[model samples]
Target: MSFQAYLDNIQAKTGKSPSDFKALAEKMGFTLNGKIKPDVKATQITDWLKAEFDLGHGHAMAVYALLKGKKPD
Candidate 1:
């Protein structure tokens, strides 16, 4: 799936947009101002998403990519 597709699937499943996830991540100290914090590991974010949102690894990684300013080709 494309990057946007992953994001869309996540939103469809979780009822949240990327902005919403960003805000929540900030609250969890995984991110700051829409960017990944220096000390935050991708696994930390993915693990939280898995536990809280039931997202699979791929979808969680999509969120990780977004945090790092990456996009699908």
Candidate 2:
């Protein structure tokens, strides 16, 4: 599937867009100023998304990609 397809499925399943995840991440101190915090590991973020959003590894990684400044395809 395409990258956007993964994002779409995630949104459909979680009822949250990428922007929403960013906001949530900030609230949880996983991110700051619209970027992933220097002290936060990718695994930490992926674990959070997996546990909280019921996302699989790949889907969680997509969110990580976004947090790392990857523009959506």
Candidate 3:
């Protein structure tokens, strides 16, 4: 799937936009100022996504890509 497709599916499943996830990540200290923190590991974010949103590894990685400033192509 395309990057946007992954994000769209995630939103459809979780009722949250990427922006919402970013905000929540910030609150969780996984991110700051809309960016993933330097000290944060991808697994930490992926694990949280899995636990909280029931997202699969690929879907969780999609969110991680977004946090890393990846744009859909």
Candidate 4:
């Protein structure tokens, strides 16, 4: 499935929007400092992405895009 598909599936499963996921991530220990900083490792995001959405890398990134507030095409 495509990235957008993964994100859509996440919403369907959790009934939570990307914004909501972001909030939850913060609660769980994700520091969204903006700009994908060097300190911001992909694994940190990927771990939560995997756990929350049961998605692989590609799909996780799609969800990440949405969390970043970028509408995927």
Lowest lDDT sum, 10 consecutive residues, model 4, at: 29-38
lDDT tens digits by residue: candidate 3, 30-72: 9888888899999999999999999999999999999899986
Off by over 4 Å in 2: none
Give the alpha carbon lDDT tens digit for every residue of 1-73 in model 1: 7888999999999998988888999899888788888988899999999999999999999988887888645
RMSD of 3: 0.9
Which residues of candidate 3, in runs, are more than 4 Å off?
Answer: none
Model 2 per-residue lDDT at 54: 95
Candidate 1 worst ten-residue window by lDDT: 64-73
Estimate, for each residue in 1-73, the C-alpha lDDT of model 4 and write its tens digit.
6656666776887687777766765665554533344465667888777886677777667656665667645
Which candidate should be chosen as best, given lDDT against the real structure? Answer: 3
Candidate with the greatest TM-score versus the true structure: 3
Go through the candidates in order and give each one's C-alpha lDDT: 0.89, 0.92, 0.94, 0.66
Predict model 1's lDDT versus the native. Answer: 0.89
Q: How many residue pairs clash in each candidate at the backbone level?
A: 0, 0, 0, 0
Give residue 29's error in model 4 in angstroms: 3.0
